[model samples]
Target chain A: MGRWQPGARERLEQAALDLFLDQGFTETTVPQITARAGLTTRTFFRHFADKREVLFAGEESVPERVARLMAEAPPSLGPMELIAEGLAPAAAEIFEGRSLDYLLRRRAAIDAEPALRERELRKFSLMSEALEQGFRDRGVDDLTARLAAEIAVTTFRIAVARWLDQHGDPDLPATINQTLAAMRHLTSHGGCSPFLTTHDEDHHRRDTGQLHDG
Target chain B: MGRWQPGARERLEQAALDLFLDQGFTETTVPQITARAGLTTRTFFRHFADKREVLFAGEESVPERVARLMAEAPPSLGPMELIAEGLAPAAAEIFEGRSLDYLLRRRAAIDAEPALRERELRKFSLMSEALEQGFRDRGVDDLTARLAAEIAVTTFRIAVARWLDQHGDPDLPATINQTLAAMRHLTSHGGCSPFLTTHDEDHHRRDTGQLHDG
Candidate 1:
């Protein structure tokens, strides 16, 4: 019986998450996920390599999309702003077809499973790597680019956490913006002259020149 | 033969790293490590649960020490500064009695294996958790405390990588300071008003009162 539905992949993921949440990730099996989705195990295999991959498949394309967003963003934007713009597409895409309840369930499953958590962190690490490369491509100093990428990713994690915690449907972009501002606040000196004031002019001038060339 | 040396644990770790590098992490066995250290298998078991434990044993105590440093740091120091202070002891302790060569080799062994890489990242995650708890204990706001801890840990990680890379024996503390300064430079806006200016004054006043009470 060769049967593959139009929404087989989404149905499989939704079914897998429901099963994982109903019992536990370790107890959930491919047959069970397929049964719940009203599909064959063969169809499930076609979509995901394994149960773990089901939760992580969405994250693979995220880095490429984010890097592209940053690369195409207006040159006048600062590194932090550019990163925020890059993250917007990811936020929208990840939560696009999923309901709030479905996302929460998915997050809960991930949280309850150590294997899933590791995969999640690894994906975030990959995203940071992509972001760092994007910054280097844009001619930012190596150290600054790396540090900025780390900060932006960290802020994104916090924003996602906050977005999930809200009682009602949350505004992910606004929450991310807030998280970025909070990160800036956490790192800033209290009422003191800005850090690296003397180097600012040279850095910005170089940044402008690079942007023009790009 | 029951020949257990004075610094059996350190000797075992050194032996393990050598074996790991000479062969590979997965190929190197408990007997090889013990034999290289001139110790019994029992001694290795007494020291570590397994070969992987040799690389991660010290991380368990790190959060406690770092949190203590942060809690006792001068009240006048800002949150970011306090976190840097908190991380100083960790840098010293990690490199204590370890040669630059030893550190590099240990890192190489860890890098060579995916299992070790996951362990390393998990340890870093634990460090961030500890730092966040320490900040909360110090009465910093939740979001700010969490973000501050993350930035500090990230900067520390970069510092460690850089310290390991330098040809000349580098000072870990100074490297950490440099990384912190670099992070500040990345986050700070040029000549703009400070982030959380009013909040800083209020937080400091409360912090001072808490210090006096302590």
Candidate 2:
């Protein structure tokens, strides 16, 4: 048997997710997670400070990468575009081809448990702050940077939902681009209706008043 | 002594905020809070399920009002506009004349404490879901409704931050409306540039040239 042994961390996370899904997050305990993973309690502790950390594996790198991208991006880009560019590759790497079932399950678990939900929000808030700092580093004003960071996050979320619904077939980068385009359309044309002048409105009303009234 | 007694819940909240601000949220406990409030443990528990609940007393009514406005709004308004209109009055009613010191302190507490931050995110998620449902109830499709809800939340966050910074002096409704207008402008202009062709060409050159050089 020349194969590399499974790391304690990996084993612990897998066991935790399984237990969390099967027995529910509230019912699952650290000792049970460690035992199922064939690791000692000390090993579990060494890997994760607490049980909740198991559900949040790999999230730490997301903000770092996003910050790096924003720092290295072209200076000429507008605030929103710069933030979007910074997030695109990171989103592509972390989100593309990811298991929707796993994500949906994790979301459900968080929704069902108050503690887990709080942890998830803390992660999001950290991400938002990181993005805002990135924009500020590029000389954007505080309020504008904060607003742009928020819009970027909003686009990321909308893209993720769209991607998840499509069974994660679309590349994350493309999905983000498409969502931005849709946002443009939404904000610009106000959803497929031409701007109506007051004259046109009155004439139309006069022309169709009986039809509408009846 | 014909002095009126302060409400138990309000007393508890004031005491909790003071203690949490002074000693930090983690270091504070129920008994200490109740003692500070000059109330019994039973009186404290009657109002709040836990110490943390005391910090977030008005969160429930904000969402309820937002949802009600969304539900009762006229059907002809665009989804985003409808959400904006729904949130504006609520913001005016709830946020005007609010003390920035308490808000800033509360935000700091939440940021410093992981549990509180997560609870805040859960609240945000609930608001987003409520907004989505509101749009759906008005006959909007699922995807569009979700997108609109996200954008609305983003606008709300920006408006809130701006309001907080202005010493809580700006009319919340006007600030919200202005933020929505800014978002619309940013999204509609397609990267916020007048010289689109040149901008795209330069962007393409940078992107492709980077790829080729790498």
Candidate 3:
């Protein structure tokens, strides 16, 4: 019951994760988590609303951090670069120092649990919303802001996938930067297709004639 | 019993949506839906496993249709163009001709219900997976495929939002095309930031020197 002490939440989280891995998410109980953490059920409840909450305790802070970072970024950086800078701290602080085995196991646990996956998706949605708002605040237009934010989220998700799959090689930030660069290349070169350039020409030619009927 | 005949599923869906809107999702019962639809509970069960399934009845077809469209796209079209073509049908089929009032109310109901929202997100994730697989089947690399599919989803979502918000202005296909074009501009100009061009120059300079450690 005295688990209000510093680091008690961390202990509870680690214990809950271990139990969820050893047994299963549904099979793991609050009492089991408390006992493993050397705490009590009361302490467990105080730290987390439920066992699942343990895995996502600090997630709410992510949007705020990303938004703040984006807001603080220098104006000279491009929208994509600003987003990259915004996410740099999260990549370093949350994903760094975690062993590959731990990350993969944690990912497995999350994948195996539907509720956790839903929660993760919700988190991603929230992050995207925050990023979109950040871009809008910087005077970007509505559609442009939304696209940039969504693309940034996609970049982050792909980078995380590569990082998790490849044992966190080159670190999260580097992977994200590389992924963004690839997207830039893909979009800029029109996927390097002459057919695309021809279509673009036709689209532009018709743009003044029929497309702006809006 | 006669509910097993034509359009029974659609009747059940319309009834469920009405009941959900009037009495709330949690308050609405299967019996209530059947009563409203002038059918039996057995018929309801035959059409849907439960009430929530009504809103998502035909959604399972979305991924298959999108994937099939992507697979059939001409190789001359680039990745983004292929995706845009894939989604052109959905914009016309699902969103066109729907009254703004009806669309807004439907969106409100889904937004108000947590379970429905979660189900929607899960459906989006599944669609992304199918699209990614479609790209992979066409010989795109893993990360590139994922990025293209995710970005396509982003384009679809943003276009839908605009359509829903502005009473389907510019129509669905046009909105999607415009959104994609904006993304193309954003990526090509690199947000028109001088800092980015310099970085790109440096990146090119170092491309053969130190970046290939990848």
Candidate 4:
């Protein structure tokens, strides 16, 4: 029972997700999880530090690998492109193989639970920090590095949302590229300055109306 | 006791900060805060919904003001500039009059506590959402608007950090302007593509190294 079997972790994760969905995260306990998995509490403890850890099991390694990839990227590549490339491999490894059902269920559960939502936000913050550090290591200034990191993360999120909607096509890289292209078009086409133009138009309209009245 | 007096809220905030600093946030209680402020526990509850709310008293109004400003901004301004203009008034109103000591102490306390840190992240996320909404209302696409909002938030954060270090000399608006200028320069200089170039260079190096060894 204590042996490190290949399917042991997956079995535990499946059991935990089943329990969490049937009974809310608050109502589920470690003993219940292990009982459902046909494993002892000690085995569960060995696999996960706590119940919360189960949800975040591979988070540590995923970010670490992405960061390493960014750091090892060629110095000549632009910041956004470097991040995009680095994230592609990890997306392929972690997200491409996964079933959409699990992700949808997990996302729904997190959205419903405040504690889980906070944890999820914290995870995104951690990822941003890692990306920022990667940029700084590559000689980007503080503000640019941080901004680039934010943009990269934002693009990744947009891509993931689109991918999820597509019923798990596993083309996260393509989705991210599409998002980046959209941003470029928006910025280049003067999308950012629309507010200024709108204000001017409003003022002109007011003046025209007054002239007509006169 | 339940009346909303003008200065009552400020007095309570001062007292709560003092108690939080003297004894850690976790160790301090509502009774202690009220006792220091020469008020009853009932008064504290009336002024602030909870102890955590004391730290975040006026923050709820910030996002609304920012959104309004963004919506009313001149349409001719670019997305980045539009966001900068929208943020300036709100930043001035919320952060301009605050003492450096108050800001530093509040930041330190929030950084030292995990719960407070999570709360801070959540607040930032909420603000980002509002900014995104403002952009969308102005005819920007969903993904572009979200990324612009995130970049704006990142710039605001960097500016605020720099402002906090100046010990009360520079105003929030000026600092924010400087940060925005830096971001514009960086973006225009092709900084975003560095990550991509770097990744490609690394790939090339790896391929060359393997070929040389072979």
Q: Best candidate per TM-score, number?
A: 3
True-structure lDDT of candidate 1 = 0.77
Per-candidate interface C-alpha RMSD?
A: 3.8, 2.4, 1.8, 3.0
Ranking by TM-score: 3, 1, 4, 2
Mind giving the per-residue lDDT tens digits that candidate 1 earns over A1-214? 5565898888888889888988999999999999999999888888788999997756778888877877888766657657656676767776687777877888899999988988887888888898889887877777778887898789888888888899334588888888876676556543122342444434434632433434
User: Where does model 2 exceed 4 Å of error?
Assistant: A1-8, A83-86, A95-112, A192-214, B1-6, B96-105, B190-214
Give the clashing pairs for model 1. Answer: none
lDDT of 4 by residue, B1-214 (tens): 4466667777888888887778889998999888888888888887788888898888887789778888788766656557656667777777755678888988877877888899888888788888889888887777778778877777777788788877645877888877765555344334654333655446434532322434
lDDT of 2 by residue, A121-167 (tens): 67777788888899889877676677677778777777876776676
What CA RMSD would you report for each candidate? 9.0, 7.3, 5.3, 8.6
Docking quality (DockQ) for each candidate = 0.31, 0.41, 0.53, 0.34
> Could you give candidate 3's per-residue lDDT for residues B134-172 as a string of tens digits?
888887877778888787777777778787887878777
**Using alpha carbons, what is the TM-score of model 1?**
0.84
Q: Across residues B90-136, which tens digit of lDDT does each residue of candidate 2 receive?
A: 66666554466877766767778766866777777888888888877
Candidate 3, after superposition: displacement of residue B3 in Å? 5.4
Error of 4 at B69 (Å): 3.4
Error of 3 at A172 (Å): 1.6
Candidate 1 chain B minimal-lDDT segment of 10 residues: B188-197
DockQ of 3: 0.53
lDDT at A212, model 2 = 55
Q: In model 4, which runs have C-alpha deviations exceeding 4 angstroms? A: A93-97, A187-189, A192-214, B1-5, B74-78, B192-214
Candidate 4, residue B49: how far the Cα is off, in Å: 2.9
